[model samples]
Target: MIPEPDPALARSLADDLAAAGYTGARLRALWGVAADEAIGRGRALPARREAAATDSAVAILARLFFLGSPVRESEASAALTNVTIDGAERLGLVRMSSGSVTPSVMIRPQAYVDEHGAGEWWIASDIDESVRPGPLPEDHVLGVGGASLTLAGLQLPTSAARVLDLGSGCGIQSLRARRDSPDVTATDISEAALRFTRLNAQLNAVDGIRTLRGSLFDPVQGEVFDRIVSNPPFVITPRGADVPAYEYRDGGLTGDALVCHIVMGAGVHLVPGGIAQLLGNWEYVDGEDGLHRVRDWIAASPVPLDAWVIERDRMDPIAYAELWIRDGGTVPGTDEFETMLAAWLDDFEARGVREVGFGYILLRRRTEGSPALLRFERVEGAIGPNAALGMHLAESLRAHDRQARLSDAELAEAVLLVAGDVTEARHYLPGAEDPSVIELRQGGGFGRTLAVDPALAALVGASDGDLPVGRLIAAIAELLEVDPDALLSDLLPRVRGLLDDGFLTFAGGEASPSA
Candidate 1:
């Protein structure tokens, strides 16, 4: 078991790291760019060689902690000026014997940019595959990975009364949430994971984070939060003695049941107007669509919720089995890999699961009346895992609420502006004066593209802040020789879609002329 965290030692370590210039950019400069990138791919030899060449405090510390390599006790003692080797050992950061100090945990600098601006935090978590090079123990705590950064980037940037970070592994989401909310509660089933959360909070000098030990929402029953962010242990795994369920990814549930449990329980713990953002997976059973299944989950919520779910990728059962089997450090040709693959396939076959869909889920408990938004879309594109999309999401939600309240006639009278990130592209045939296809492309926020007809494209092009929607359509109708009512009827619903997708926005007021 990991030792309980000590705040004084964490503070000292933080100061020593800061003084040593131990930052992501600085470390990347210490090693070449290729070596830094190689470390991310679990090949640390290049970085190890680079660290061996330098005797600086940062290099010595990196060798001991970041690379999980043994270091001479004298060098470690000299490197860690504030938190000495004894303090580090007591804090469960390292173990010392025979004039050598070996790392028990890794403290790496993580850099992030969000709506609150850019900053760096030192994240301390258990040693990863890069250092350990084997199948992880079931209780292994995870450091920052792709999924962690995804949920962290997806967290709403707006202020909140309180936030709950369910399944906070290395406390990355908790740290990110604390930037906006004054209070954050990070919960995990493993006590060791909670200790890391507490230690990381102290190391980063970020307060107002309370760590609890429990599975799912057991630690926060009957309590309501303004926001909830989670990258949960939603990985589907077979239930048997032969199969290993890593606590970091698998929630010990069958075939996306864990995601369902969290979705159903979220509505109960969210305050009215509260939002819950989480990454999840859902199984497509036999012929049932996965997105529709998620829609049903929202419909079955005790408290009606506004839901927006985007399925980013889908994998067949075979692909899914291989992906997770390899994630457990099993090579493709190995006997254990084949056994686990067979077990995973058998489980999927038993459940009639044909495919699994992975995506982002945003749920909002309604403040009053029934839910208004229920969008489940399969977005296809290469979106950056750590893109700062919270600002776009918040703006889109506000636009949705505004347009949802407006009647068609009222919306027609509202002045609108095409978003700055939106662009128009026209494709013409050879020797043709008129374009055959007109596409409106979004530079951000899902990077959506829409093909528009000439009338709609003309209306969009003419949507300056000076004129209201009704007038713009009228002018376009005059130029195109179409009936004004016919054009308005054709354009109103598309305008609403543009608003919801953030292609356009109200100039200032919901139904007022732009000033």
Candidate 2:
């Protein structure tokens, strides 16, 4: 059930929370450090044990919401002076029965920092397995989780008149989107989810997020948004009696078809030059690559788009099945767990599935271009600091647009600056005077490291915004005794790659999208 929302009471609750200094940092300090870390691993006992020691307002709220501990009515009311015990019950946040206050849902204090600033939100949603007993309900609404944070971090910090948050569970993405876009449209199939979204918006005291109830793009058909973001329910689940389809993860379609539909619909919903970002899972079956299948899905879009999909990791059928089954609250070493595992295995076997690929998908509608970009690859290493990734992505999109218009000769005439966070490392044999390996490592962006031939390394070394790339190439060639034309031919394309990947940015040249 969606929490009953009283905007007036929610505002008071927010005030009370702020006055109590309730935040991710304060909560961690109130409880022991180990207990804080245990919360992420779904082991709430440590936190519960520590929380039991204090009846302070913050501790009480943490125990009630974060640790799922029942609270005494009078104490809870005293802590939340504005919301009060009766008001909390009126807002459907807690149940008052037998003189104790039991939380009907969890309201976590989420801390985040962005280009705008640092802030916190009181995010409310149905409790998960970590805090709840028994199996999760089918229509369970999820609170702040890893996937939500991933999609939240992936949102480009670019300005837009309108933004759309597809499948906005608990409205986390919507809150994040409203950071850049003045107006945001949050959509979902579940009415309860929409209610939670509304309640969350109210709790945050953030305006301009209008919630709509419908599946996919059905709620706002024919409307165009400057940006669309989704952390859709893309989990591939078996369609069987024994298996339970948790609405928070599974999209209730065969395989990754729901993901396919979401990808295909991006073109229809976004305006020209608009962008869509999503996190999804794709299946690899019948000897086909999952990434290529995603490419095909983009190619089949009614509207042309420049696609960049990164496969973070892949899991074989058995491992994937076990992971999801365990996530569904079915512990292993039990008959029910084995039966559910069999159902998943049988489903995969019937479909010829071999593995599942999970990752982020980025699509941008082509403004007008003879050469629309399509980049698909696996990022094997950890992505750089996530908080700054939005700004990084915004710069990347701008760089792509600017560079796409420049030819090889034009690119050579532009001055570039090596990114500040970049460094060069050389490896050599102990007895050798010369280095055998040279790598250009970026400490930011995707945290990529590239092996560079001596000539390319020299070019990067001399790129200090003092001379045009062509002039630098000419000087390096003269010093190294290589032909200038030949050197330019060799390194200009590599320079372009560096520019696109953010190892280098234009110094005196126009590279910013606004420019």
The TM-score values for the models, in the order shown, are 0.97, 0.97
Our tally of clashes for model 1 stands at 0
358-386, model 2: which lDDT tens digit per residue?
99999988876534778898987777545
- Model 2 TM-score (2 dp): 0.97
Residue-wise C-alpha lDDT for candidate 1, range 262-329, written one tens digit per residue: 89999999988899999999999999999999998888889889999999999999999898877777
lDDT of 1 at 506: 88
For model 2, the stretches where C-alpha displacement exceeds 4 angstroms are: 384-387, 509-515
How far does residue 299 in candidate 1 sit from its true spot (Å)? Answer: 1.0
Q: What C-alpha lDDT do the candidate models reach, one value each? A: 0.89, 0.87
Candidate 1 vs. true structure, TM-score: 0.97
What does the lDDT read for residue 310 in candidate 2?
84
Candidate 2 lDDT (Cα, whole model)?
Answer: 0.87
RMSD (Cα, Å) of candidate 1? 2.4
Off by over 4 Å in 1: 384-386, 509-515
